[model samples]
Target: MEQLMEYLLHYVWQHRLYGLAPLATTDGQAVDVIDPGVHNLVNSGPDFFNAKVKINGMLWAGNVEVHERSSDWFRHHHDTDAAYNNVVLHIVSAADAEVRTADGKQLPQMVLSVPDYLQHNYQALIDEETYPPCYRIIPHVPPLTVHNWLSRLTVERLESKTDRVQQYLHRTGGDWERAFFITLARNFGFGTNAQAFEQWALTIDPQQIGKHRDDVFQVEAFFMGQAGLLDDTLVKAERRDSYYMRLKSEYAFLQHKFGLTPISHAQWRFGRLRPQNFPHVRLSQLARLYSERRADFSLLTETSSLDALRALFRIGVTNYWRTHYAFGEESRESDKTLQTSSLNLLLINTVSPLLFACGRQRMDEDLAERAFALLEQLPAERNYITRCWERAGIKAAHAADSQALIQLRQHYCDGKDCLRCQFGALYLKQGRS
Candidate 1:
């Protein structure tokens, strides 16, 4: 019973469902409910009522208590405050009292409940583990509504990403190109090495880094060294021949010349990961990309298609990286090339979103649309978050659903802001209205 009540409260609160219409008065009076505002006593207390509420053809006002039950109002003490005087309805789940407003007026209300099937369905979803029960069972759901919702949710998701991007942009002093490079490096670092990549960017000045454009290998070496991938303690070979050694020496030269700070010796985690995903290789790829496209984000801004994004992100490693994962590996490197899907993930998750955000800031809808299309073309990402939504009877046919699923997981489920969700109250009411 407690769990059910808690769920109901969460559902209502998350969805802002409290004070909704069809409220029942304490005396079981049947009336049409009107604009149910949040009940706050401070402002309304000075008057004859603690709150002002209305019912069908009646403008009710008084200090009366509302609750899941009439007994709870007394339990909570509405009689103490004149602020509750305007409560025209003694709304409750079960009515059993002769409650009155401070103005000495009796309030009317209505008992509201929803269908049983919807309730059971909602409960099953809230408690299930399966993904896409509706998609798997019901031949189809309405695509038009789903599509529209997806589009709306996807843009909302982008706005959130843009918010973070804007913060980074401000930190970078609105240098979109430098900001983008740092973003790309962070994304390339994947989940584990993001800190190291960011740290690497901080040590190297973006303007000076552009000078080594002719030799992509030297550029990659500098980035790799700055990522702490060229530590002499970790490498087995001497500093002149091995990849790590070469990078270390080059980095030392650059640091001396430009007075650049050394990247911290912090581990850019590679454990439990495929060698291809090692921070060294990622940094190399990033440096190669920057070296090849000195114009950086300006070039990316001009790009409009998935093909162009793929081309931009596909910058290959130098010959040395083609045969090595780390500095000492001489054996045939199996994971020599970056996967196209991985590139798409970086572009969609990192580049495209930032581009869209910048586009919106510049009032360039066309650029934003191009970024949107790139994201849409990619296959939806499957994760625990999406699985939960699917279990909840929500189906995704595209990236919009994926975006909503992420937001749902981040801001709603994980944050426990169920009452703040659009589907929460209705979903709860459907179960036990």
Candidate 2:
């Protein structure tokens, strides 16, 4: 029950979801919450920062700490930490014990009662079997409200992706080109092999590959060999894949020359994947792009049109991959390349985020605007999530809307964290009028 209280208290306090009545601290001093303060997601000092409140007709500005019970303050040892010294108000569902600062000054404590409507409405939303908890209210929500909320969710989703790119830049020691490659590689693997591709990218040095960029075969040898695809154990053992042996031999020489070690073969997942999505095909296409200077970040940012970006990522695998999905196994000869849908996905997931991250780091507003334009230019993704939202009366008009829906499904819906979601807030406010 305490855990449940802790979960709901934070959002309730932030949203001011309490009865409209005069309030006072446990010691009978008047208190009025002005701003509940910013919810601290990343830091350790306080649950909220820079809160505003009026205590006994005096305006007090400080941080706020909240919990299921007031005794949790000492249980968490905030009283001994100097960081808690600035916390002017301790809000809890129950004032179980007196809290103090490191200097032993008793802190003002306020008990916030849970509104019965919120608890009942939240429970109903959770109990509902619909894809979106607030689907019933969705149709009633003003179109403008839906539009504004989706716009915010879209930017939030993009910003989250941007944070990932920034971390890559940090890990790559501020090398934008290397960071872009890793980001593209992960997206190239798209569904199943994304993690394996990222691990594979981290092992290979981008600068070392640049030296042999003139030769596509050398690049293939480096990429395939480093991915552990050339290993004898992974190939279908019945047929001796000569092309595999050839690349293995070449990679042997290159591996010796560059002092490189391949990632373990066990890392790659193959079951249930299509022929085109196999590591060999995708990695070969990547090798082609890298060797041909097509995947260069500087050139990509200079591209201005959606068609131009499509052409940039529309790379085909080398001749060997064109004939086979795996080493040693030959299939019908066909032109194997990124299809239109695949190209769109690459643009939506990889290209836009890269542009946004580059724009922010370089302080170029054009680049940031380009990121938004790219999403706006693309069609909505045809997936279960979009279909689900469409069933809920919220069809995605573009990639931005689809991405926002996906974000909502993943972050808010999956966690049942409706208290922090706007849609949930509206559903809870029903019948209050």
Candidate 3:
């Protein structure tokens, strides 16, 4: 007998992928599968429920329990469990032994073997080295299939982010502005220091920052101070840099007044990051946005154009950041402006989702449609997932396509959960009726 997972048997039974001729119980009663029942996604009591079958010309309807072998019914104690009493049939790959209900009634049993091609195809997915084990078939897949699945995946990706947005709202006491602040802050970390940025965002009193929001310098003080970046060590290192001294001194006074505590400076990551992306610089740029642009939540809900949203995040860093990547280290004066590409990323990862979430919360379909429209208009994001998809005979044309590809990579490819993936399902169903 071939080694098998019970899930594969469930897949076989649910899809009616078994010997086409006929089936019989252990006692040789003629059998026919009417319906295999719904597969229990929650993995509850029964493997499947509401099944219908015919045995010895009698119609029976109830739950179904599948196992690699009928003996597992006993090994798992289902024989004595009342949950199995309603099972009209026990389907297994092997009929190792008989199964009886808790009331001592023998249940009908049928042996179902996996089609050799299906097992071979599934094993190739599991054993293949490259991602998307179905790479070979991607080009040949119907274009309509690819389009529809990607469309569904893009919405799924957006919905998943909406949950995180709701979490931020819960943390902010239903304050949309503060929730947006935290979400945008996390994205400012640009992947490496995102967690640290989110942690820092939670530490600040958004109202207190709002009070001093007019002064960009004070905003920098609050931002850097809460990030735990304005230390005495920085003051000492940049003793001659008056900018560093001013931020540190102002932060101390504000910290005492607001009863604020900062996240450990160690939380910010610097290794392998460019000077422009350093936490210190990004934090400064964000501070400028708060004081100058104020990036109101209303902007996201009302703003729909790619250009308009990009302009919103284009708030450049103050002069201090224009010359320094770190507290003490003064580098050549650079523009220090948020690049168009980085702006696009912030729009894709932060703004669009924020808009969609606002729509969902407000029950305004227009805002949600605007969110989708934004991605459709923007260029595709260049990232590992998109690159891999490009290599596998598909290329993303815009942010929507790229976002779907990203969802596919994270939710399916990474987990090898191809059994649930639309593309994976198509790949498996190839050549089958």
Candidate 4:
């Protein structure tokens, strides 16, 4: 078993899972646990602190130390460290050795007794091969319990994303617009090219792009060139394409003027991607957005309704892209517009998180709540993880539910952090009862 099983011991102790039987110390002295004490400590001294217990009809209050085996107390060399001097109880899964303090005084030890079925159930979860170790038991949990957990997990996901936005804001010297642009650019990748897009965004100054936003062609040239899509060699080889030639020439002038370096096109991926999701198409759509709404980009955080937010992203690529997914390539005529699914992704991953971060930095609760409200109005995402939850009989009702499930799967279930998960904890508790 992994060392994480030690947390299960902590859970058993915290919830007093020793059953209705009388408790006692290792030396056969009757014992009673009055208060499990505070488990939250910033700097660790012991596993638990300020515990109050009655031993042999005498009350004793001190710290409680836990381990898988009593010998770990000495194995960890707690005898030499003054930190373990005030330990009133040494709770372990097995008491294989006598524990003594630094002053050579015998400390009370107890072997924590847990129900056999609980341990068996936890071990079964650990050995389970499913993505969520407790998938089989998820439906057994009360709906209210699952809803409460999902709500908390969704906020946790939002807070984590908001933290990233805050880091970017700090890196950009508190420039909210630039941070938003970088985040939006990354999201445009839609998971396939997010990293390359982020690197490309970092290379071009948003102010430089904003300077030429009045001309959609100039914005397109700058964005495409910075993304390394308008390389001189590639453009020269496709000289027969007038639109490619124009962008190449404009990018050359802009590159020299701004002394801007472009990210390598080798970083972009094209395999297994839909034609509409090609990097060239995504960049064009992003270029159109900035070209039309450079000055009002920050106003997106204040958008209250889902329709208003959706309206802001209702933009299509320039006419040049209507017949092409990339330079020097001709396909059937089609309007390269941001689809509803793509728009929903942007609102969930980029817009809402940015809004939440902005609200937190400004201490505006209304804006933060508005950001969460927008998530409620959006539809649930359809992806492999959501489908896994669906197969397990957990259907996500909205974006918040789906987002929370994504978080739960990635952070808790995948890592086998059952002790920290509500579902896992409930499963263990139910098995014990």
Index of the highest-TM-score prediction = 2
> In candidate 4, what are the lDDT values of residues 1-433, reduced to their tens digit?
4254467678788888888888889889998999987774357578888899999999999989888888888888998779989889998888899989897879999888667877887787888998677888888889999899999999999999988888778888988888888888899899999999989988868767768888999999998989998876554575438898789899999989999889998999989999999988988888888888832545786667788787888678889889898787888998877888888999999888887888888999988887788788899999999998898879999999999999998888887778778888877866455
lDDT of 1 at 68: 58
Backbone clashes in model 3, listed as residue pairs = none
Residue 356 of model 4 has an lDDT of: 80
Candidate lDDT (C-alpha), each: 0.63, 0.88, 0.85, 0.84
Tens digit per residue, CA lDDT, model 1, 1-433: 4335434533332233555555444454445433344543246332123344455456654433335555555665665556666555554455666665556655464343424554465565556444332334223435565566567768878888888678778888887876777777777777787777776775667767778877887787677666666666666555335555667788888768777765766656767988888776677677677777733778788776777678777765677777877665664754355688787778767777877988899999888987788777877777787776666566565565687778766766554444444454333344344
> How does each model score on TM-score?
0.71, 0.96, 0.89, 0.87
Candidate 2 C-alpha lDDT tens digits along 182-210: 98999988879999999999887976888
On residues 103-136, what C-alpha lDDT tens digit does candidate 3 reach at each position? 9999888887777777777777878998668898
Question: How far does residue 224 in candidate 4 sit from its true spot (Å)?
Answer: 1.5
Single out the weakest 10-residue window by summed lDDT for candidate 2: 233-242
Clashing pairs counted in every model: 28, 1, 0, 0
What CA RMSD would you report for each candidate? 6.7, 1.6, 2.9, 3.3
Clashes counted in candidate 2 amount to 1
- Pairwise TM-score winner, candidates 2 and 4: 2
- Give the distance in Å from residue 147's predicted Cα in candidate 2 to where it truly belongs: 1.4
Which residue ranges in model 2 land beyond 4 Å of their true spot?
none
Model 2 residue 70 distance off true place after TM-score fit, in angstroms? 1.7
